[model samples]
Target chain A: MLQIMEGSHAVAEAVKLSRPQVVSAYPITPQTHIVERLAEIVADGELDADYICVESEFSALSSCLGASAAGSRVYSATTSQGLAFMAEVVFNVAGMRLPIVMTIANRSLGAPLSIWNDQQDSLFLRDSGWMQLYAEDAQEAMDLHFIAYKAAENHEVLLPAFVCFDGFILTHTFEPVDIPKQEEIDAYLPAFNPYQRLDAKDPISFGMYATPDYYQEFRYEINAAMTRAKKVLREAGAEFGEMFGRDYSGLVEEYRLDDADTAIVAMGSVCGTIKDAVDEMRDDGKKVGLLKLRSFRPFPYEDVRTALAGVSNVAVLEKNINIGSRMLGAVGLEVKDAVYKNGTPVYSYVGGLGGRDIRRKDVKMITEWAETGRNDCFFGLREEVL
Target chain B: MGIFLRELRIHGRGGQGSVTAAELIATAAFKSKIYSQAFPAFGVERRGAPVQAFVRFDDKKVRLRSQIYEPDYIIVQDSTLIGDVNVFGGMKKGGIAIINTEKEIEGVPDGVKLVKIDATSIALEILGLPIENTTLMGAFAAATGEIEIHALEESLRERFPGSLGDKNVAAAKKAYEIVKGGL
Candidate 1:
């Protein structure tokens, strides 16, 4: 049934339907509602799962790691500084090869202390070996969680996953989403079966300290598994589409790129605005398209290359800046890497940082600039006083 | 789907039901079978601050998620919220605007269709509170003619679940009659 619901509530509902055996979460703004609803579900016996109320975000992930290592499907969520607090455990979950799926309500970190939406929290952990997927809206946020769980738990890709949604934007916004019945979700995702566990009867040590001799191979194996996750993401996303009438491109979702002269590369909520801008631009005879990154961690380089290969020009919009690089990180540079040999110029934009509103007109203007083949461009900024 | 995907900009001081009104609107929308998304954009998260909540709804699944920069319709719960942020920014050209204060909407900006009601008075008469969220929904139904007043009442019942729902439904009905009478 269609129901009016906030982004966080949608995520909580998806988590319930996913049927995680263990859930541990520490409350933080924008992210709190997800856990609150989950806790209520557990308390009311609406969901048959253990809801561990932890004192901090760090413990939340740590407890999930324990549950997952013990062959139980584990879930947890956090935002901004709460995620930062759990950063160490984030890397641990991946290294231990625990198929834990986490929801990150993407928010800006604070010094002047803001609880608003931004990509900094999740971006900081971009290299943590967890497959990160950025969701553009509530429906995608909820759907991506299901996909993330399936991909992470695949035997060939037993890596942790973090499905991110913009704080307050998707987290607090209400929209109609199809809540797949629990039985449907169950049919799509099988019960968790651990490849190996710390069973007392079988007694095996996990995460043992490795010296320089063996550490490199262990690291290589993790990287190898991540590479495998890219294909697994594609297959699982296709499977998700077939099961529930929604099609997911897995690594990236492309819109109107075929025969387009210029394009915008972006992740998360801003893509929706860009899509609107692109549609308007197209109506006015501008060949503009949008390339939205779904799988950010495994980077999805090959898919990105294929998507942008035909466009005459491409511009990447980064919500979080690497500060002082004067270059786009991750998605921007990756797109450049994909098309550089083909001679197509790709521009990079660092915009919408710290929750500064990114508008559609800004996207239109940037796309117009890219068509001219300039070195690069910025959007929505006052002209430099210099 | 009781969820009416509406992006509402409420203009009120710290104490009014702007954020609460947004939440109630979302709760009521959810009750309607449409998914309602509501949130206040407050720097301090303080009361008496300028606040806004965005909502989106569709009979089908909604995928393009972000703040409703472009609203199909806008409800200004407090007439005061008009000048704080760009309440009219990104509103559809022929979209609906429902306001609370007694000011004639004709004096307001011209772009989208505007509807004004004495939401405060409606609240006073029905719920005995100056907070005009429930009352405004009635005006919202009248102006936009999107969701039926009965749907809003059903939404209130689902959200409040007690006498609170009963009072809100009464406020909605009274406000609905006033809005319909004007039309």
Candidate 2:
């Protein structure tokens, strides 16, 4: 049935349906509502799970890793500073090959202490060997939880997954969502069955110290598993689309790119705004399009190249900037590398950091600059403030 | 405006229930079988700090996720925010501004309609407090005709419940009648 609910509640409902055995999380803004709702459901006996109130974000993820290694499906959530605090455990969980699904309500890292939305935190952990899936809206965020669990628990691809949604923008917004039924979700994602276990009867070592002889091979296996996870993601997305009505079968979703000369590539909730701008620009006789990168990790390099193969001009609108690099924004740097063989000019435009609004005008201006081959710069920068 | 997509921005201080008002409006629109969404501008706002909330209504699923830069209607829950913030920024031409003030406000942009209601007085008289969020929903229904008065009242009752719900419903109904009577 359709019901009006906040984005956080929708994610909670999806998690409830996924039937995670253990949920551990510490409270953080934007992410608090998700864990709070889960806590309520657990306390009310609606969801039969252990809702652990850990003292800190590090403990929260560490506890999740412990539960997952013990052959229990586990879940957790965190944001900017909280995610930063748990960075050590985050890398450890993936290295241990535990299939823990975490919700990253993307927020900006602080020096000025801002509790606002940005992609800095998740993008910063791009090298942590976890599959990163960015959600464009509440519905996608809810659905991706199912996909994340399904793909993570696959024995062939036993890697952790991060389902990221924009802080406040997608987390606080209320919308009418068609939440899936428990049986439907069960049909799509089965019960957790672990390939490796920590039972005393047949005990096996996990996360032992790797010497120089075996460390490189273990890292190579992780990279190999990550490559296999890309295929697993597509299968899970296709199965989810068949069960539910939304198709997320691709690493990148193409919007009106078939006949366009220019395109803007983005991720998360900003893609929705870019789509709106693209529609308006199309109506005004401008040949523009959008390529929404749904999966940022495993880096979808081939799919991105194919999607932008026809467009002469491409713009990467990113929320996180690589402060010390010449390429500036992370997404732009990756896109430039992906299409370097095609010799396509990729413009790096950074905007919407720390909850700054990226309106239609900003998108239009950035796309126009890309059309003119403008290079690295921040959109909507207040020069006077500098 | 009644049939097309409509956007609304509500300006209020923290603790004045502006966010709740936006939710209630969207709920009322949903009750009327219209696709709608509501969300508050998330910030570290303390009590009595200036805040903003937004609502969108459409004939289909509302997919735009950006904040409302242009709104067809504006609701000022705290009249004092008029000078402190640009309450009327990017308001559509011939748009409506439903303000919760007894005294008339000045400098409303030309071609935009203005409707005033003493919602604080109505809340105090009917609900025994100065929570005018529900009361302003009544004015929104009366001025815009986008949502029915019964839908707004039903939403209020469902939100508050019991005697508190009854008091809020009475307050909303009184404001609805006042605004409908051209007050």
Best by DockQ: 2
For A246-309, candidate 2 gives per-residue lDDT tens digits of: 9989989999999999999999999888888898899899999999999998788999999999
Candidate 2, true inter-chain contacts retained:
0.71
DockQ of 1: 0.39
Tens digits of per-residue lDDT for model 2, B1-183:
225789999999999998898988998998889999999988787899999999999998776777887889999998999988999999989899999998879989988999999899999998889999988888899899888888888888888989998888888888888888994
Q: How many residue pairs clash in each candidate?
A: 26, 0
- Supply candidate 2's per-residue lDDT for B65: 74
lDDT of 1 by residue, A56-151 (tens): 988999999999988999999998999999999999899999999999998888876888877888988877889999998888899998899998
The weakest ten consecutive residues by lDDT in model 2 chain A span A377-386
Worst 10 residues of 1 chain B by lDDT: B1-10
